[model samples]
Target: MKLDVTRRSREAMRAYLAEALDGCYEGEPTISPIEGGRAAAERQLSNFDVRRYASRNHVTRGHVSRMSPYIRHGVMTLREVRDAVFARFGRVGESIYKFVFELAWHQFWQEVYAGLGDEIYADIEDYKFPPPVWQETLPDDVARAETGLVCMDEALRELYATGYLHNHARMWFAAYLIHHRRVHWSVGERLFFAHLLDGNPPPNALSWQWVASTFSSKPYYFNRQNIEKYTDGTWCRQCTAACPFDQTYDALAGQLFGNA
Candidate 1:
């Protein structure tokens, strides 16, 4: 899988990139997998082409996430992913730039984990302070939250079927899950990462922490109006509704419930 990426798709991607790059970039590729981001970019750009790859090619949505499983396995490298796309459409210009930029985002997120290390696992600096003692078992409410009881509509249902959420939906969900539902971020993180196709450790975990006020940022807040407005009528579980993290979750769920 990884080899195919580096060899075939990468070759195509690079071919395109080489052309798009032209005299515009002489110094190097922005990153190199071998020497690190900067070096890798420079090295890969060394020999590139434009005409051969990017044009008239169909970069499938399936293709976008296909490599992720392999990437998780470590058998496939980011270099291969980049090369494949670039070699194919590097010359295609702006379109490929967006694609490449997304790939770069993947790289950037990985570095966030690498640089932050266990700190990614730590509690956020802001907020009133004691970490909520988590229960041994997740609450019944947690499962209901997934049932779309919180926000029932096409988009919420889509999350269940597709096992995915859009960027905005995800933030809203996370906000609802943490601040409104009153659930522990760790529980929410595990549930999400366990299911999401695009799950990456740092981003998944840390971002949840961010929503949970376990991160340094101010606690996120949303009412029903925000959900109704943004989802374009796709979902409408008012913020006033029950959430996994709401104060009620603390009162009624589990044996000890969470007041302990």
Candidate 2:
């Protein structure tokens, strides 16, 4: 089971895995361009400035730490990350709250899964919206990033090529699939599990349910303005597709949930 890294270049390692584990995986054989191992993890952590993170982490090209793969795989622990942040910035402040809350959020999902086990696969609560007429599978257009919506298409393409999507994009895609497209939350959850490098059931599945309004008080949907604000209009500027997200929140709510 040991990979002999002594002689292989990164590309060679990727090729080796693709050949060795062929048919064991889906899609093209790929490795994240993000490097692995403790040294790389330490370097990423060292470069992460909590100050910049607090202000920009929600945006498309934000100052995210890029430590997700490492933390997800245990190359870095949540405690280690928290301690690292605390060492640099004091634990008690608005600056650290968002970043810390993210860590805690992941941990909270883990705890929920631990307690509920396979029950997490079922609805934890009823949808806050009307009963959904749900599709059980990811659509071909979506799987291939041909949805014609720039944001969703780009997010899917990013996931296919790099095995990563920004958190904002993930939420948007989930909401789109579940609400706009009438696909089940589990369908998008499985799509993410199949592709995301940091895909872990507790957060991935639960977050999808939360967005689908099966595990939260309401569904989470976003408007074009919200996307433009967070992405700085990057996708919208180039996007020629008729935007499903162009409506106001009230309009979206009625359109998506009124008939439930």
Candidate 3:
């Protein structure tokens, strides 16, 4: 079989991406946010010890692998990444299990896309709970990252700047957009796809649906307490907004889903 590839210098690639993504980004990304190519991916894979995987959700700790872009764009394959993990850690027991499971999630989303085609963009099943009214357009506050909710705005800024977010951050953002803002899940889905380097349609859309309660048993909502606990109260201390998320889950559910 014949193979073809296009390669560009780092400067040329950066300029092209900046121009191509022009207005879609809110701010300039970190310099060399991440590198591409197989070598870089392999290096990242090699660094994936099991200790970090165990603490991946700590926003303060921030111990993610940061290799989704490579996997998404085919710079590396899931099989190779998995084999590398196994080679290092030996069997698929507790130590390497979580990391492997994360890899499996990527493959599961891909398999769903392969089976469902474009239908992944639509709701996969009836919503278990009533969702708020759906707005087709992305809210200006969200797009501009001026939502006043400190954690959310910060997460949006990070996404715009890095083309990536921690999975927990992504879930919180999606839940806020769908359940709190009442924007349609599709609107947030498209925005994420536009900004994320690892933005594959199936995972993005389905995950948004999961947050929105269309693909899961209930909508996902988070409060200020949870944010404070995970993010070390960084966003909360400096926040000026009225803090809509201060309420309990029941209070939020009541306010968000009143008589629906």
Candidate 4:
């Protein structure tokens, strides 16, 4: 005798079955799995080369070394990555300088975390202006990837499906959550930590604070123009929602903080 099941029950059964098979895979992953161990990391280091280091900010134009997972897990040391860059580019120049500056940020965050310990999870500085009204919990729309913002929804989907995002995309999403959605940074930080393969507590939490203006001199914001420029207008082209990021920086400042 077969029992009839509701749609919700069917979904539950599927999810349970998937969870049960989680680590039993003997075949290739649907998405390219980030290979583990020192050999894979070394290969990635070789591919990063010097040119890629110079173009890290050209999110839509070029590639970045997808080596953060290796770095985060201690499979590749920070010093080793730096040495590789230096060897390829020499000690000083715009490209080498930019690359080292970014590396320094990771070390700086680690130092701050070591000093503050768990306090790194809290607001590091007073809000530069009045804080926006915020909920401690992540918004349902963001969690469900139903935010109606094409750029944000796409970024969230990439993060969930691949466990990675371009660094610019991360900043854009964090700023949207903190200043635009008016959610606390901690909520976004926690969400990032949960999904990011490269997620480290210090860098994840501190970087969110940097975007929210709790650690920086002012909040970071991006409008439609900035997104279009960096993303090559892909998200803006087919977007149907009324874009909150459509305004100029001055206008956004006025709307977000009553300052222009």
Best by TM-score: 2
Q: Compose the digit string of candidate 3's lDDT tens values, residues 1-260.
A: 11222645666666676777778655553435678789889888777676657778878676778889999999988888888777778866774788888889998988988999999888888776665567999989999999998899999988887788888889889988888888888999999998899999888998998887777777788888888888989989989999989999888878887654
Please say which candidate is ahead in TM-score: 2 or 4: 2
lDDT of 3 at 14: 68
| Model 3: how far residue 161 lies from native, Å | 1.0
Off by over 4 Å in 2: 1-4, 23-28
- Sorted on lDDT, highest at the top, how do the candidates line up? 2, 4, 3, 1
Best by lDDT: 2
Residues 110-129, model 1: lDDT tens digits: 88789888777667465433
Q: Estimated TM-score per prediction?
A: 0.51, 0.93, 0.88, 0.87
Off by over 4 Å in 1: 1-70, 74-76, 88-99, 128-137, 146-162, 213-216, 221-230, 237-260
N/CA/C clash count, model 2: 1
Q: Candidate 1, which ten residues in sequence have the lowest lDDT sum?
A: 55-64
Global lDDT of each candidate: 0.54, 0.87, 0.82, 0.84
Residues 1-260, candidate 4, lDDT per residue (tens digit)? 22335543544554554566778643333342566689989998888866556567656665687888999999988899999888877897776777778788889989999899999899999888789678899889999889999999999988877888899999999999989888999999999998898999999999999998888899998899989988889999979999999999999998988852
User: What tens digits encode model 2's per-residue C-alpha lDDT throughout 1-260?
Assistant: 45677856887788888888988988778787888899999999999988877655455768887788898999999999999999988888876888998889989999999999988888899888777678998899998899999999998889888988888888999999988999989889888998888888889999999998888988999999999988889999999999999999999989999954
